[model samples]
Target chain A: METKNDGPKQEQRLTKKGKETRARIVAAAAKLMFERGVAGTTVEDVQREAKVSASQLYHYFQEKRELVHAVILFQTAQVLSAQEPLLSHLDSIDALWSWRDAIVSLQVERQCRGGCPIGSLASELADSEPVARAELASGFMKWELAIRGGLIAMHERGQLRGDAEPERLALALLTALQGGLLLTQVHRETSPLEVVLDAMLAHIGSFAQS
Target chain B: METKNDGPKQEQRLTKKGKETRARIVAAAAKLMFERGVAGTTVEDVQREAKVSASQLYHYFQEKRELVHAVILFQTAQVLSAQEPLLSHLDSIDALWSWRDAIVSLQVERQCRGGCPIGSLASELADSEPVARAELASGFMKWELAIRGGLIAMHERGQLRGDAEPERLALALLTALQGGLLLTQVHRETSPLEVVLDAMLAHIGSFAQS
Candidate 1:
């Protein structure tokens, strides 16, 4: 047998094909969860959708709930990672407008499917399940922190007015985003999201250095 | 036997005691629902907690699902009716500020449990159940319309800027309110809501005649 490596071997041991299989399983689980809601989705459904054997799926994840938690974390990171670049760099109101556009486009592209994935999950179970709730809370907290850091940077760089309340600004931005997302989901259209995003940008852009 | 009105006849017609009992039952459902969530609550739990017999509860509500729908409407109306007088008479920025303080205190007094009862429920099961979902949608639509109408009147009266998009502004305000509610639920505090509301007032107040 080949010698075991000192590292996790997650990348090396799993063949390129096996890695693809694992990703496919996760994507399949995510799609199913999106359709059925977290509580309704079962491991068997994921396995069937992924076309993977029960043993193989179990080999990848020990328990169904654990796998769901993994899926949640996976999706949470995916959403947060998407905003990394836009949220990480914002030195001025113009930058905020550009970032807001990216956010609106991301939300609009999805056609508001069942609302924000993380918010939807949070509302679904609220704090019913400890692990899921923690994951959900962590996801939102992480997203909020990213925005807060961006605002702080902008404020420190003198791009934002010296009196701007960074924390309150971030909170307002988040609430506007959430409001846009919920309205979009309810109407199953992008108009509401677009309007809210535009108004938000207009409101924020009023502070531009012009 | 005395002539009866319908299902369960009372000693006269809805005595003060009877009305209080009904209100208590609805309040009990709302509290349990906000805590354990709607999906986790059952009629049996409501009956036990409300200390009302199944037959007595049925007299007030046809079934568990119907009871939830009634709760949704009652909660929606409760929220809207409370704001109606204030919003309806809102003709100046100072009045709006007073309204904001009242809202903040209302939410803080209840320990942040006084969320937009309709929004919380709509966020969860609005897409899951058709009938209940429609009822919730209608409830929200009515509440938003009321605000939109109020803003339109204000704009027409020159209290607000003529360019004010009353309808869109109203929707955005509702969305922000819901977002504030979500944050309040997460933080278990009203400060988040207060700050957001204050920021909202700042935004909206900018357009009001000084």
Candidate 2:
């Protein structure tokens, strides 16, 4: 659990308008990277999409790697925020199922076009970019902890079996999710996501107090 | 379940030497793609690594997409074949655990450098290349069928509970593996794969007959 404070330090020095410009640039980069991938999207593409000049983009991000790091943090927050109250309150089996339904429905609505934003980043940059990989790993750790929080609450409440390990269960659920999304994205169908999440939830349910 | 006859038809017409040359080019492409990614590796890189003339490379693969398709098939076969009799015979829980050990050990031996070859490809190319996505999906389907074959055998033999669905269980196992591998690759550790797979096996074990 090594925590690295890799957030862009330059953001602290920016004025209100400068911070707005930086946020806009990161959002533009995130969108393009989501659609065209990190390698496929260029600095020029971000500049053009954000309506910012090269100097402005560079001022916010020293290079593409810095921008990609910003995008990872942006996506991490975006994804977890989107999961919201559901992710924060997985203390019961019913709540977990509801969370699963929310996730699957969102994928179906999007037609499974983009897999997990953090996951796609991990797949592409894990090996080649060590710094980015660490950031992505940290992002996943945060996600796992969020899932673990609910399971731990259930365990503490005596809702889960005494032998049930919340940390392991949380990791399993996240793994199933990442795998399901990958398959769903590849097949362009929601069945894989549905099947995997259902399976994980069923496994979690098995530990519920009868 | 639409099967596309997308294999290079011209490969069938090649002489032994021509086929060897084609394979050499493909093996090189697969290596580069695995190491550098589909976008990072260029046709020229493959030509240089394979030590084949551009004309000969083109003779086998008319485009990068075709080459990526070949790599998908290559890695699929390579991965599945490496699993051997274990993948083909998952009749009992012991057998299944043994298969899990084999997979986990391989990841450890490789230091988890390359995630799943087919998985990484699917992550990178699934959305961008529809044809490759279909082929990668087919590869996953084949892998799933192999896993299902064992569970189905167990069900037929009364080793599993009557309510256990082999297809769903198999897909769940695959999903866990894919997710585990992705996380393990990002973290550069085998614990994620081990934890997720162990949870999946525990779930499957719940259906085991006494």
Candidate 3:
């Protein structure tokens, strides 16, 4: 999704300390940005939240847009890392269901306060900020690829019918998840999400080898 | 979806001239808000864009939040109005596909520039703006109910299997459309929308009794 130059070039060649400091700024920005939108969150807020000096914040990020880019990447990695266990093992229908249950439980734990971090950014910035939009799009592609990989695995394991198109199915599954999360965030209830996921999974099951 | 009071009443009691002026403000605000998010769009921007004086803008809205509420309602009406012809006639499977094609064509016509008007607002304001979130939630509910109505018609006609749950299926269809719209907005491509809708519609067809 990120099409612009990585911006301020030092990200690729940071020293150990520099990397840690940069990561700290990004983590803090991600949290604040998630709670408040990009337009609402300021660089001063990120500096205070990260507890880094102004110079330190500037050292890593030349501008707020650059910092936003890092945060997008950070959120993407965080989301993927959280689901790695279930996503990597989605070689069977049951495994996929487990993944759905886990997602629902996690939402309950959060009291359904925040929607998908990456998705929230995509919604806010995708159209207005070209560079950030590219990064957000790439983040989604990564997520889609992960789901597609699992579906492909299911196909290879003979869990799904030979005619089942893993790419389209995975895309549909992700779409359901994204839509479900959006509704869940709005309603502060998990039922919308559950209904959508159930339907998506049921569709997936229809393709299960009989 | 909207659980809050509509706030600062009298949206229903405007004179013809008052109604036209208010509608102009709402339309201008919606366009600006869609292009630049809520936080990014200021009262001054709305006044300038709407070609109304500041006092005139305030006379109608009282605050930016009130304007946002109106815009939310305006967008809901705009979206529903556009789909009324197709959405109202979703009594057959072919009608639904025609609806999908019409949607895809509209997206291509816009060069996939803007996503769903209501969804765009929801993504930006749902978490931070409680009133707007409630309004957005209500907008989604209205959209969902419309879809559900059509599905119920199908079920009554015995087009779908006895086990088909219109409520859940309508929710799922709406979810797919929302997710598809979000992705389509980000990628600036119609494929994501097409893929997800095709998959969702196919799933619905699975519940069709031969």
Candidate 4:
């Protein structure tokens, strides 16, 4: 059932050089898309940036859509890995505060230039590109699940109330985070994110088992 | 103050025909941008879609960036005017619930296709396009102000506690709304938005003067 268009699947069977070239192309595309948006980045631009020949680029991604899909997954991993240390320590409120601080500080350090990388991709592709849309949704789900797991751990430790719904609360926290990033991304300031995280954390604090 | 490159200021002095043509171009651009995004859209596509001659297009918007700015304003107005009626009734907690219902209903009606039109634009242009970024930020500010004004009204009526901090609460509410819309847009479901709004409203209810 393999067709000529099954370039992506066959790409997985590449040699180490081919795999490295593929990864390099994806990394270049991700950086370009982050700066210029999915619509702005072109296959030619990726080829030039990644220093891959057009044939080599096509060997990895048969189409631009396929490349974008790979970029979404790449960004999802990049965003999550950066937060892994904080994510693993979220059993305590102090850990949550630390996590929030890390996020804000990262924004500040980047001069609030780029919002959440995964969020930017999601916003651009969600409506127009169906495949990328699903992948982005899955990315958000993974992010929310990570946050929810931490909340559930806190509930198990009796830090949160018995009635606190971990799933809903985690969704809310993730939403606040996205909203804050959207505002901060536009304003090029950390105030919106700070205000959002603080308010959301206060709401979470209210549910503590006193 | 009359510079040669003052394309926008001169546009304000248009005749009836000129105004209509300008509006037509903006509306067409907005529609295309909504579907294809700013990067994917071009002057040629807009000219064809708007049915304006090349000279006419340049007469209105000297460049694509100028057209994008107009589209941003168009979307801002489109988003705000739809909620104007509900926004005016935020004097009571019931009004807030009604507003929330209206938003959810609107999303359901659209099958959760587009997130906030303004939000989508913000995510794409915030970093790459400075003027558009500022315009998008202003749009969010206007939206936040409307919400903050409502909360302030409630606080003034003693419906909310004296320490409710309407500004922060409004920002938080706005954040939650944006986050919910982002998730909903990608998932093509109303549940993410529904859950976020409900949880945010519950938090607001906690500040009610009982």
Candidate 5:
């Protein structure tokens, strides 16, 4: 139920070219943070990777914390957008399985390298960075809502049992995905992701109308 | 499937007093790393926290990577030992629910503040540190096996359907747990963890013997 109201708001004032420069910095920072984590990725490193001078980087982000906020927004948008229409219409068991397949395939493609971008941020900042934690929380809320949309549609169509709670079910699916990705990333294998998603989808199937 | 053969091996040669000093250093390092993350916690912080001189700290650990490996082992042992007999005896639905309750209660007691100790380390180190990743993967494998022990016992007793694979089920439970804890930590609530565990347990119950 946590809402996302606060994000890096400097973009509204930037010209088109300025926006591009800012976004390029965020992209580089995201990639580095995803690989090395927040504490390991420094402002100087972001500057080096983004090919921007100290003045240019500081013009957009006053500190690494601000840059981190931008990265959270960037990664959240990327992850949610990647799911696209599939996440919006999880109305059937088959549709859910398709979503599962898409997730597993992506992890397999990456050879289980980086864990969930938002999740990695959450793990690193949840204890120390209150602002980052809120932003990440909002990102998860948005994701949970996207997932809930599908289950809500299924429930409305009477494809699911009366006891099936769409909100809870959607949250469970997202939770499984996070855990699966973490395990898969550590094990450098796809089975953890595959197994957890399959288990969640199977749980959903158990609620199907018969 | 990962094995835990490699841990900080310096303890084997230490006398009782040496072992205590080494353990004190690891405990301090684990506490700092748990709060500030692996990259954020430096050797100086650990030495200061443990009240040890630099020479003494160097005598025990050659570098921070060795210290991290020690922290991983310490956390893994702490987590598994805390689970105790419950993790060893998750043979029935009621027993599983009890285990779930214990986990939730601990999270709530902590006010949902530090995410799983092992999970936080895995998130920060899994990608950057291969040795630490293997240590974490081994920890998860051991935890999975403990959960599997109960499920396998139930399966052999015909308490579950023939189709139920204990290994997969145990992995699912642990996966759900990691995801739920991550969400709960970010949102500072207990529902995500509660819902995921309940869903997974319900899924397990669906395989109950008629």
Candidate 6:
């Protein structure tokens, strides 16, 4: 009887440990993925990074695809974290431009290298299957909405112009960053990216009072 | 003597029939890449689509990677072709705006789908190997020069404000498009992307005669 009940009871008992081990595996995978493109990240590499044996890695996730999906979700949340606080403070034009500048400066310093982990993963996963593509799509929707909501809030406060199109600008800003990053990465330089950001900032400033 | 003669003979031998066959193979490969994603495209599927036997396919290209490289070069040329006359005609703000609009409209309609194929392939292939990445990088550099040259021409004609920074603005335009594409593709919408374009256009217009 005890043996029969142990299956469910065993899972419950192992829940904490299971979660920790799973997180370790994902972190390991993410690091490897960033250091070497996803295609270069082998299952064995991930297992070794996590300090787990092959069987243990497979036990947590059936395959590398499943693990990658989990990582996408994890990375999306991390991106959001970086954009917050500053985002929430955009109640005035000063705040918005400051936020804009913050974004531009950060990207310039970083030289638009690497990529948005979520965006990068989405490109890979979307072309493969509808299910995975849907997940990738969800991350974008959520990201866009976060920015849109802030823009709308600023508009309502009279800090933004009455005609300000927040959602549209937000989408465009996101897109430019992505494209700019590609160019910057290819050239291993930042001038082109800076030009785009400078133009955007000037445009955004037009809606704000001096 | 035989080896030298064969090498030169093979280099010169792209007969009409052979050219058509090679074209078919590349077209099939591009379609498969779009539908299945680059990683998912298989040599067998490409051969089937082209309706060629394995021996014939291998005869044309010694390996699948060679076929892919050919496809990339072909696609790079296609994109450049689309932008040519416009690229050469950016002698005024109106020309620049019209050119920008054409690109934005094309992208938004596609819902920011795919991405700059050259850039996408480059990002994925950068970690693939140095030689492959170098080839990919060359394509993007060519693209940048094409636009930068246009901007330089516009400036020479005194169409752009003397104080204006054409190179930087060009980079910004490209960046916004990339980011917008990612956003639109992920969200399955175009409104956000258009907003970014509008903002980008408005920004550039500030430096125009109008």
**Whole-model Cα lDDT of every candidate shown, in order:** 0.70, 0.90, 0.86, 0.86, 0.90, 0.68
In order, what fnat does every candidate score?
0.27, 0.75, 0.63, 0.73, 0.88, 0.64
The C-alpha TM-scores of every prediction are: 0.77, 0.97, 0.95, 0.93, 0.97, 0.80
Q: Candidate 2 lDDT, tens digit per residue, A43-105?
A: 999999999999988887888998898899999999999999899888899999999999989
What does candidate 1's lDDT look like per residue over B54-171, in tens digits? 8878777777676676577677778888875776665566766777777777877777653567767777665666566667667777767876776787788887887778787777
Q: Which model scores highest in DockQ?
A: 5
DockQ of candidate model 2: 0.81
Q: Model 3: per-residue lDDT, tens digit, A96-175?
A: 99999999998899887788898889888888888888888888888999899989988988889999999988888888
Better of 1 and 4 by DockQ: 4
Model 3 whole-model lDDT (C-alpha atoms):
0.86
Write the residue-wise lDDT of candidate 3 on B11-47 in tens digits.
5677888878888998999999998888889999999
Native contacts present in candidate 3, fraction: 0.63
TM-score of chain B of each: 0.80, 0.96, 0.94, 0.94, 0.96, 0.82
Q: What's the CA error at residue A17 for candidate 4, in Å?
A: 3.1
Give per-residue lDDT, candidate 4, residue B28.
Answer: 99
As a whole number from 0 to 100, the lDDT of residue B41 in candidate 3 is 91
Backbone clashes (count) for model 5: 0
Please identify model 5 stretches exceeding 4 Å from their true place: A1-8, B1-9
* Candidate that beats the other on DockQ, 5 or 6, i.e. the better one: 5
- Model 1, A1-210: lDDT tens per residue? 011221125435788888787778888988777666776678999999999999998877778766666667667777788876877776567677787778777766775557777666666555456556666666677777888887787777776677777887777777667766766666666666666656655565555443
Candidate 6 lDDT tens digits, A1-210: 122232234346557889788889888988787656566688899999999999998887687777776666667677777777876665555665676667656666765556567767666555454555676677666676776677677777775687777766666656666666665665556665666766776776677642
Residues B105-163 of candidate 4 have per-residue lDDT tens digits of: 99999989989899999998999887788788888888999999899999999999998
Classify candidate 5 by CAPRI docking class. Answer: high
Each candidate's root-mean-square deviation in Å? 6.6, 1.5, 2.0, 3.3, 1.7, 6.4
Stretches of candidate 1 exceeding 4 Å from the true structure? A1-29, A42-68, A106-108, A127-134, B1-32, B42-68, B82-85
User: Which tens-of-lDDT digit does each residue in A1-210 have in candidate 4?
Assistant: 112224356666999898888889999999999999988888999999999899989877889988887888789889999997997667778888999999999999999988888888888988888878888888888899899989999998889999888788888888889988988888889888888788778778888884
Clashing pairs in 3: A1-A134, A1-A135, A1-A138, A2-A134, A2-A135, B2-B138
